[model samples]
Target chain A: MSRVRLSFTPAPVHVRTARLVGVAVARRAGVAEELLDEVRLAIGEACARAVALHRQYGLTELVLVEMSDGPTYTVRVIDRAPIEAGLGLAALPPDELADEALTDEALTVGVGFALLAGFVEDLQVRPVDEGVGTEVRMAWPVGR
Target chain B: MDLSLTTRAIGEHTVLEVGGEVDVYTAPRLRERLVELIDGGARRIIVDLGRVDFLDSTGLGVLVGALKRLRPVNGSFGLICDKEPLLKIFRITALDQVFPIYATLEAAISADSSGSGSGE
Candidate 1:
């Protein structure tokens, strides 16, 4: 397996840097053109979300992106911004929350996890460093 | 990558041609331009994304915000994008139905001329 890693400050400008590096690495790994498009969008959203989270919490830790190539392509975006209790797990009643309300909230809440889930084959969100921060892990089959 | 925006008036509609990446960093620049155009009495706008290399949710959020801003005045907003990557994100977020997307700049401008520019 081949691996690539990048570290950058939790700044908006650096999000594009991470996305470019991720796409370059995926291209070098022989990822298909159709898949590369998805990969690029995925990385951009992940990095953008990380930057927004760090800015929201006033955290200074660097956002780290790690990519691995093998039978599958995997990428992990890590941030040090603390995940609040019951965050991203609330199950809102469809009757109570209007679609417009949800869309408005999504603007400030970072990239929608549902969107990411639709793009990648496998996606997992978990607290890292003893629940002090969050890690977004996503992977896709290499030949797909 | 950096973003560059150039604007021109197409009849009563304003066309903003964007080039380069529109991620979190460059989205604010686009947002500012959109705000300026709208606040400057631009009632109809067409954003040509043919030259845009990238767009994330941050960029989409800006577009959505612009749409909302124009709604109060019955203004119109449209997008010209044929790129699959950009289209995919719009589909994933169900925003494809929210904004009228066209294959070319001329089509987008004319779309509003037909009195079908009001956003859903």
Candidate 2:
């Protein structure tokens, strides 16, 4: 297995850079062309969410990305900003998860977990290190 | 990558040609341009995405926001996107139902000008 890690400031400009790096690493891992688009979008959204969270919480730490490549490509975007209260996926009731609740304004305002969930093969969002921040874990098969 | 937008007036319709990547880094610029056009009384707008190399959820959000902004004034917003990668994004998000997407700029402009647009 091959592993790569990248670190970036919580800035909008770095989101694109992180995405490019993820795509490059995925390409080298033999991820197919059609799957590259999904990789690109998923990583971009993950970085964008990280940046927005840092800005919202007035945090000053870097966003870290870890990638592992083998039969499956796995990416973990770690943000040093806590998930906002009541916004955690586990915190919301089942009824609130409906598509009607995701307004354009809401989606634009940093509620992109749904988009990430839709694009990746697997997704896990959880607090990291005694609730200091959030980690977004995403993975997809290499050939898919 | 940076985004470039150029505007042209086609009779009653306004066309905005977009080029380059439209991700989180560049989507804000597109959103601002669309807001400016809407604020300036542009009721019929066509966004040509033929030159756009990439688009993500952030870009889709801006397009949806623009469509919502036009709804209050009975404005129409249409997209010209033929590329499969871009079209696939819309399809994945089910946004193809929200915006009137055409395969070409001429088709979008003609349809909008003829009052047979889908944004209504």
Q: Among all windows of ten consecutive residues in candidate 2 chain B, which has the lowest summed lDDT?
A: B89-98
Where model 1 places Cα greater than 4 Å from the true spot, the runs are A85-105, A108-111, A129-131
Q: A30-88, model 2: which lDDT tens digit per residue?
A: 88887888898889888888887788788888999999997788898988775563135
**Of the true contacts between chains A and B, what fraction does model 2 have?**
0.42
lDDT of 2 at A94: 24
Per-residue accuracy of model 1 over B1-120 as CA lDDT, tens digit each: 579999999799899999998877888899999999999999898999999987777777788888888888899999999988778777766677778999998788777898876664
For residue B77, give model 1's deviation from the true position in Å.
0.9
How would you encode candidate 1's per-residue C-alpha lDDT over A1-144 as one tens digit per residue?
999999998888787778889989888777887788778877877777788778877888899899999987889998887676213633233232224555644653433554576688787778875657788888877663
What TM-score would each prediction reach against the true structure? 0.89, 0.88
Model 1 vs truth, CA RMSD = 3.0
Q: Scored by CA lDDT, what does every candidate get?
A: 0.78, 0.80
The candidate 1 chain B region of ten consecutive residues with least summed lDDT is B88-97
